[model samples]
Target: MENEIAIHNEIDLQSKIYTIRGMKVMLDFDLAEIYGYSVKAFNQQVKNNIEKFDEDFRFQLSSYEVLELSRSKILTSIQVKGVKGGRAYLPYAFTEQGIYMLMTVLKGDLATRQSKILIRLFKGMKDFIIEREHLISYDEVAKLAIQTSQNTKDIAVIDQKVSALATIIEDFTSPEMKKDFLFLNGRSVEADIAYQEIYSQAKETIFVIDNYIGLKTLVLLKSVPENVKITIFSDNLKKGLHQKEFDDFLKEYPNVTVSLKRTNGIFHDRYIQLFGISEQFTALIVSNSVQLEILLNL
Candidate 1:
């Protein structure tokens, strides 16, 4: 019973990251499903074991949040069981620690397995986010494009550099690479088709250094094979509010690591090291400042 609940929670955790109202915490629903009791029964367990859930461990949604969730259709459609208030049917949420405590309160073989899987899932998410934060800051990219536009001796030189960069990006999407990857041109619409072709041949890993990563980017990263890794080199400038969530996620993945270093005096060199080993790699560098490389099969 506990194992079933934990598995259900794992699936739930993947979607309800931001903790809007309406999403049921795993243990609540899982226990209810197993014990033939209401979510209130699960809540009673938590109430009985308050020590298990600290401020860092758990929290409830605000009335305003609950209302917003109701408006947005983000809350669960499941009817409330033991809840006595108007919000009983609304979804509730829990943190990693909260879930852990809930398991201790429940006390069963299933509870133990559920707790382990939950911790692992949370850790994995943390690792992913931390790795993502290491990507290039948006300001750095803008500064570089501006710097090149201002300093280049002739428009042709700037054009040539952009062309070369475009070509290199295009080659990444070749047909030969398609079997291994499903690349999408993130930086430019024009690069989309070509980038797809190059990515098909990719193996072992995929690296991307871009300014921004939203939901679409996250989905793509998750699509890669487990054996393959991805690394990004970029500047860490902004303290976006959502940044913390991602930072927490990167703590989960052991294979992925992030490093923040200088690129050029002005613009950070946003590059990737894909399918590379430590000693043997290939990279392109235009200026003495922005050096890019791939270490093949390290």
Candidate 2:
């Protein structure tokens, strides 16, 4: 039974390995599944021992990187979910060394045996690639075949980018104009445009109210003029954005300020209030739904 389980695990590990950023990596979701743990639990362990995992050992995937992997045929077999449910944060990827280091952190007999099997599987894959490289060097036809395979992969990447570009163009060229009330279904191109427009229009004061705000929200405020005074009102100062990360964001935009005030169970909605140079106030009430509704005072 132990032998059978090891064989199954080897096959499963092989399937989960992916090439991202010129390195082979296994996503946190798949790694958690192999270790017999929930995604949240697995990530929590990593967070607890963050000092063990360096930039080379593990790295979080960006939104664009995640989108690219989603569109790839090679990665289609992997279950990559969007920022829904309990997966609001981005996924992390672990390299071969990182996987080995993870075993040291994970406890129990099952983790020990599984770690040995995974290390063997990783070594086998490396040997196989090395052998293939040697074979390709001796045979011209083999080299050509490898080159053609890479070209096909490159074409697929290009096709995916073109499709994304077409979608953005369609959103921009659409005849529908901005309305006082807008319903945004997730993070669409139109929603991004609206966010930018709101930030750009803030001439004097820009006030934001949200329970949780991350690096993505900070990026939207980058377009605010230097003279504009930006203020953030939140229950927690470092809920989504860490202290160090928030400090860096402040360095980039020195005009911004943050204030924390606990509602004691009253505030629950997200809002953005902009004050123009002429003291004209405009407010945007954002609904906390999968399809976010933006009530704008134009």
Candidate 3:
């Protein structure tokens, strides 16, 4: 009877797993309930053992993310109550590692049993995803090769799928090169790092497309090799002081050749395309507010 109950609990737990911030995670409230603790107490214990959980293991959902999750129905009950009501706190989300680390801090027999079950479930889910990817990769690559020999339209579709699969494979194999989607509200550290990475890899040219270009955006390009060619396609050529700032930057970096063009057509989005030797290129599609960045290798 006890074994059956545990099996049932594990099955229920699987349904609670959610993909947030491109990671599989569980909300603090749900985990607390499964571990037989009140939400307040469970979160308190996590706070006390904060060192056990790093940014990758646990993260508090942002307001934008909270709204997004609620709209998607992944977080069915998410809402903001009055500030005085103590229900206004943003929820903490725990990844697989965070869930496992909880076992070290949480006490009681129920916690122990649930932790063991959860660890197994998390591992099983990871294994399943990896196995499925491997199976799909073999089938997809064969189809893609055959499609390439056929026509341009079919080749384009195959190329897109192959690029996506490559990203997935890189994320699984080369964890260090795994792409990160970063929020770009302010001076984003991740954005700076990404810029540095792209600049470091560039051997020939850097192409940029943004409707509006400002000094802040140009700051990210300063570290590019002095010999590399830079091209900017923008809707607005007159950015007042920012244009002057870019002029000064060009004067300072004499070896860098930058050409700014007023885009002939309406282009609403931003992209940073880096071209390297032998036709190798990588691209970053950035949001207008600099609020989002998606990195892709081609």
Best by lDDT: 2
Q: Which stretches of candidate 1 lie over 4 Å from their true place?
A: 1-9, 20-37, 73-92, 136-298
Candidate 2, lDDT over the whole model: 0.73
Candidates' RMSD to native: 32.1, 30.0, 28.2
- Put the candidates in lDDT order, highest first: 2, 3, 1
lDDT, model 1, position 92: 49
Q: Per-residue lDDT for 1-298 in model 1, tens only?
A: 2224433456655554554333335434544554334567777777787776886666655556655544655545433434454434544467666666665677666556655766777788778769988887678889988889777757888899899888756654555543333223322223233333333334676665544433333334443445665554334345321455556545654444432333333444434445633343333222232222322333
Candidate 2 regions off by >4 Å?
Answer: 1-7, 77-86, 137-298
Candidate 1 displacement at residue 132 in angstroms: 1.4
Across 33-112, the per-residue lDDT of candidate 2 in tens digits comes to 77777778989899999999999999999888888887887776444446444367678999988999999998876777
Lowest lDDT 10-residue stretch of candidate 1: 283-292
Task: Estimate the TM-score for candidate 3.
Answer: 0.42
Lowest summed lDDT over 10 consecutive residues: which window, candidate 2?
178-187
lDDT string for model 3 (1-298, tens) is 0111343366888978888977899998788778777678889889999999999889998877777777775457654433354465888899888888888988877777888888888889878888886466666888987777777877789999999867654443454433343433222336567667666677888888876677756777777787888888886645532667878987886776888887876776777777876556645565532235555647
- In the predicted model 3, the residue pairs found to clash are none
